[model samples]
Target: MAEKFLQAERYEAHRPHVRAVAYRMLGSLTEADDALQEAWLRASTTDIAEVRNIGGWLTTIVSRVCLNLLRARQARREDDIDGVPQTQGAATVVDPAAEAEMADEVGVALLVVMETLGPAERLTFVLHDLFAVSFDDIAVMLEKTPAAARQLASRARRRVRGTPPPTGHVRQSRKREVVDAFLAATRAGDFEALVALLHPDVVLTADPAVIPSPEPVVILGAHTVAKGAMAAIERAAATGVALLDGECGLLMAQGRGLRLILRFAVQEESGLITEVEVLAERETLAGVEVTAL
Candidate 1:
């Protein structure tokens, strides 16, 4: 009874820190909670005498559980499509006091950007860069060599730091502008305007199956994307529906219910938009807020 009490006490004390770590790793509050619950269940079944450092052991268990979840996610992504490549960038250094000010604005935006990173790279970078966990410790959690963990952290650092040119606050504002313009163009059927906004090397990719493309089409360059957009708009119009606010708003038919709400991402360089990523996944769009037009 005494030993059980002691173990429970230790687990309670360390739960908050473990939760923080899991939340940062998974990027979803719900997932973190679930992971913590599973970790605790595993810990409860283990022999108390065999474990030396209870805190460390609990943390490792939590991390391993999160890692397994991440692996499953990666496998699903691979089977669905050729997996998205991991990012290589430097970590953003935000001042403690300034973090609050940036919470809703920059903080949320940064979290969204972090979604682009692969699970392992994100875990390594968050542990090493954000939470100050040693690479050796992270390597243990990941079951990888320290040298490999460090390499993943370095790549993540570069990707985070390498803003699409311009950098800092100015870059963020410009990105918002590009998104707004793209949304406007798609709604108004302004192909020329949309083409003008895109960089010559612009690349547009929509989620497979969700967007209902005849095949996975990768449109290169502003002109090409503009043509594709026009075709898409025409098809949508034929169905007696128009996209609200270009691509950022919900899709509603003349007499039918709301079909889907599309979320867009615009990556820019040197003030020119280079990449337009449209996510039409119903599951992904669940939490997104779209304005009614």
Candidate 2:
């Protein structure tokens, strides 16, 4: 009993650190909190005495939990071709726009760039670059060699290097140009043109309110997602250019009723639009900043 109490105390000491790592990996506080709870449950049941570095152990456990969540999320999103938003409000009744509002507070620009990475790449990058986890530890978690883990981090690093430092409006003008091109192509329903405007591996994720389907849709690749973009020509034609949480995006309204918001992460290298996250929750849309087209 005494040992258990001591272990719990130690875990408490590291809880905040574990949480920050989880949030960085998952990009959702609700998911991050869930991951932390899961980690605590696992930690409480394990042989705490066997562990040396409690902090590292807790981090590894939480990261693995977050990775599993991401994989499951990706799997769930695969079938949401109809734009069904996943029903997620029952558990936590916080502000719907809280996620977008967190962008500025949590380095939203970097968070947006991180969303573009794959599960393994994201895990490797977050654990190594942000938290200073050794590649050996990362490899063990990934079931690969240290060299392989290092390589993954290196690849992610190259991509992250292109992300600007999230200056307020220094790049908004340039970003608007990219977003305009994509919108123009989307409004025209020019499949080829839309694909050309998007990165070959572009990703599109959206909230349920905007998508109005049973599950949230996450379409990947320029061609597959471009088809969806083409389908939204009417909405595209009606969308106004806006700044979502300080990043370039689109505002959608229906005769003064603000309907949805489209946030973007435009790539600097190829001048291609890489990510399009639609937030249609009325509250979320309310928080978006609309700028001049």
Candidate 3:
């Protein structure tokens, strides 16, 4: 009874920190809270009488819980490709405002790039890079050698940083300028400016997942696409310019997931965006390579 009481007290004392770790790992506040509860339940039954570093032990427990949760989430996403409904965690209602708030606090750019990483890579990077947890300790949780754990984190870091811009018909510098301007105008909700950056007859094509229509959406005319861009300002705030399949484009992310990729076709002479291809289908997105510009 005494041991249980002491463990509970310690767990409560470290709840905030543990919750932070879980949030970073899971990216969803609700899921992080769930992972924390699960961690506490496991900690409650563990023999902690001989534990020396109570905080480290508790963090490890929480990390393992979060890691398992990430893996399960990943598996569910894979199943979704086969049209399987994700019943688990569906009943738990999540507040969109809260999730958005949390995503802002966690750095949207990092979360966006991290979404492309594997579960182990995400866990390793979150534990080691964000929290400064030693690779040796993380290796134990991942069942990998310290070097292997380090490698995973390194790979994640590369994805996050992405590669340099590729040589193309349009000047790389001009491509960067256009993408930067487009993102700035979109986030600022400057419709005219956005339209000015686009060709007069610009075509915007989006996968069905983006517009939820029976078929993929094809919006013609610069003004029409600009209007659509206005409605997505909030998402624009979380978007970043990236090299998509050797072309400069924008990556749109929500929470820790890559929601869409916007690839633009720049008119070499005018530097205006002639085409905007919005890729959101899981299969299509998997084939699109993203690198840093």
Candidate 4:
């Protein structure tokens, strides 16, 4: 009975960590939840006496499960007519105030970029680069030679070289400043200032489930995006939604629950905002924490 209780405690302790790992690997909450359930089942069946570090063991199991699922998904995509794997495009924009609200969690831009990698590459890169897990341990879990795992990480690194490193602690602080400016412009209905911060090649996409447009509504120039922002601001003003700071901030609904929350990313060429992305879905907001603004 004591042993069983101990095992239960260990499981509970590692549950949140496991969910985070699974979410990062799979990029889908439903899939991560399934992987977590399987990890728990495997943990329960194993003999607790042999497990020295229950947390590590559980994490390993969950990672492996998520890796396998990613591999299978890749394989299925390969068999499709186009023979190209599906990739997540740029995220939808939300109210800057709403985004300011969720600043404590993962950045939306980082999450979107993560979807560009293969499952193996993402898992290896995240483990080795983000978590500082040793290459050897990652190799063992991935069932690959250490050298191969190293190569996988190298390729993933090359893919992201154009973008700023996502793991930097300083990036978060800089992003908050950009988001604040964005919300203020939106609230004040300043289209020209809003356009000044956007990149020339900015793209805007509405939720497909909501908009059902076949193609992503790509807005090419900063001026064009600013015009659209002006229209959106007018619409939002009609609804009494105000931008906080310079970005979309708070989102309150009558009875339907809150709508889109804003999150921002600023790509710096020489310490200026280049690319800005906003994410509003609740599922996307799960890992994010909103500060009181």
Question: Residue 181 of candidate 3: its Cα lDDT?
Answer: 96
Clash pairs of candidate 3?
162-292, 163-292
RMSD from true fold, candidate 2: 13.6
**Model 1 segments more than 4 A misplaced:** 49-53, 81-106, 164-293
Which ranges of candidate 3 are over 4 A from the true structure?
1-17, 42-57, 74-85, 90-92, 104-118, 158-162, 166-174, 207-220, 232-234, 254-257, 267-271
Model 2 local distance difference test score: 0.74
CA displacement after TM-score superposition, residue 210 of candidate 2 (Å): 13
Collision count of model 1: 10
Query: Which tens-of-lDDT digit does each residue in 1-293 have in candidate 4?
Result: 88888888889988987887876676555566788888888888889888888777887899899888888877877787764545533433345444333321433334444556798898998778766778899999978999999999998876643333346547655665665566567767777778777776665543432234664344456777666555433434212222323333333221112334433445665443544333344555444433222
Question: What is each predicted model's overall lDDT from 0 to 1?
Answer: 0.61, 0.74, 0.80, 0.60
Residue-pair clashes per candidate: 10, 5, 2, 24
Which scores better on lDDT, 3 or 4?
Answer: 3
Off by over 4 Å in 2: 89-103, 163-293
What's model 4's lDDT at 291?
26
Q: Is 1 or 3 the stronger prediction by TM-score?
A: 3
Task: List, residue by residue over 1-293, the lDDT tens digit for candidate 1.
Answer: 88878878889999988877776666555566788888989988787787787777887788888888778766766776644444313333434333332222223333443555687888888778877878899888777899999999988776654433233556545555765566567767888888887788878776664467776557798899777655554423212111223232223221111333333345543566766554555455545433221
Local accuracy of candidate 2 as per-residue lDDT tens digits, 1-293: 99889988999999989988987888777777788888899999998787889999999999899989888877767878976756544343335355444433455445655666778889999999889999999999999999999999998887655543367565778888887787777766677887888888899987778678888889999898787666543555445565555566766544223566677887887788888886778677555444322
| Per-residue alpha-carbon lDDT of candidate 3 for residues 123-212, written as tens digits (9 for 90 to 100) | 898888888999999999999999999999999889877766545545877888998999889877787899999999999888888778
For candidate 1, report its TM-score. 0.50
